[model samples]
Target: MNYDIFNGDADGIISLLQLRLANPVESKLVTGVKRDIGLLGKLTEKVGLSKTDKITVLDISMEKNQTGLVKVLDAGVDVFYADHHRAGEIPTSKHLDAHIDLDADTCTALIIDKLLDGQFHYWAITAAYGDNLIAKGDKLSNLAGLSVELSEQLKELGTLINYNGYGAIVEDLHFHPAVLYTALLKYASPFDVIADNSSPFYRLQNAYQEDMASALAIKPDHQSDKLSIFELPNEPWARRISGVYGNQLANQNPKSAHAVLTENRDGTYTVSLRAPLSNKQGAGDICSQFETGGGRAAAAGINALSKEQIGDFIKAVEAFY
Candidate 1:
């Protein structure tokens, strides 16, 4: 059996594309939403333990899936693991062929594309843009001869796909990410899909842009040099647009830190924190002060913050900056 598994976001899709371009084959594909990075263990547990079985894993790094990776490789399964995430300590092995790089400027998709000798540079460009590595994105874009407008379109699509994966459950999203991935599977680029006007990507793009407009209007309650806290009132669009709202805020206020608080269905709030992208340190630490949140130093997330404690959280965030 040959298995193809990926992250289920733009990066994952692009990584899979690069692999297919380089070594096209018919394989059993295992995938889920962007948050399903830890699903590798379940796959290993269920799949038959056969030495001849083969697997290709991308985007999600070995460090993130250490135990499961070890189990599958120990079974004598031939595996190719390619990823770009913070890996503290990667195990050394022979069955497991690992291609891992944790550079903020490079994502897994681009890594695979490079490994494949730029067979899927266009897709790699989109994945890099989606991961917010514009310099890398442009490098691939220039090499692929992609138009500026087309690059922006893919960037838009990538951001939308990434944002849709934010909520704790699929129910919180405007569309299930699995369904969205399926819709995108047939198309090579977002520009090709949206160019026709009647395509589903166009409709989704319009909906996402409108929701973004609504979400961006709210003013931050406490704005300072180091921090800004923008609160979203209880509403469907607000919840749906929370991540994009955070991205937009982070862009406009590039030098300052931002905390995006969206009221949950239960009356509490979910917070997304981004320290200055230029100085992305300690953001994950600051968000960990709250419950259910951890990320890199520049960006972090919190599942639920009590409505009453909103003020105190803002104070801590300001102090952290």
Candidate 2:
């Protein structure tokens, strides 16, 4: 059996899209909402334990999935892993093929683009945009000789795909990540998805606009020179828009860090933290201070944060920036 596990967001989906497009494969797709990154352990729970099974992991943090990865390797399964998040300690195993780059400017799709020799460069660029690496995406677009209008089109497409991924669970999402990935796999280029009005791109675009409008109406709960925090009520729309809204806030004020927190059912909060665009560092470190927080430096998130710890999170962001 072959399993493909990836993050549901733009970077993860597009990374796998580029790889499968370059090297066709029949595999079991494993994914969930954008926050669901601990995936390898789920694969290990599968019924069969076979040394011949192959697995490909993308976008999720190796540090978080280390236990499952080690277990899989010990079982003699062959694995290919690629990501840009913090990797605690890469295991020494011939069964593992890991490609990890923690540079804030690069995303997993771009890393795959290098591996595939840019066979799917446009899709990779779209992922970069969706991943909030706006400047990097623009640089790659210019190198590819894309017109400004075409670049904007890809940006919107990427943003919409990314917006679809931000939900508390698959039920909260506009479309399950696996279904979205399968729909996108039909198109070799991201532009093709834009041209096809019937594609998931259109559905997500409409949904994103509605959700974003609701988010835009809400003012920041806390604003400071170094950080701005917005709190949203516990609603599906809030859950769906939190992450992308954090990106929009960061883009609006390049010098100020931004946090979008949505109330969870347990009276806790789901937090999406974006480092200042001008200084893309320490986001992961700040979030990692929390029990349920971990991600890349440019953008990190906490699955659940207590209402009491809200002040501490803000203080940490302020002290760092």
Q: Pick by lDDT: which candidate is best?
A: 2
lDDT by residue (1-321, candidate 2, tens digit) is 889999999999999999999888899999999999989988787646589899999999999999999999999999999999999999999999999999999999999999999999999999999999999989999999999999998899889888889888889998899999999999999999988989998888888999999999999999999999999999999999999999999999999999999999999999999999999999999999999999999999998999899999999999999
- Residue-pair clashes per candidate, as listed? 0, 0
TM-score of each: 0.81, 0.99
**Where is model 1 poorest over a 10-residue stretch in terms of lDDT?**
291-300
Kindly give the stretch of ten consecutive residues in candidate 2 with the minimal lDDT sum: 41-50
Top TM-score hit? 2
Off by over 4 Å in 1: 45-49, 139-147, 174-176, 196-198, 233-236, 263-269, 284-291, 304-320
Off by over 4 Å in 2: none
Error of 1 at 273 (Å): 2.6
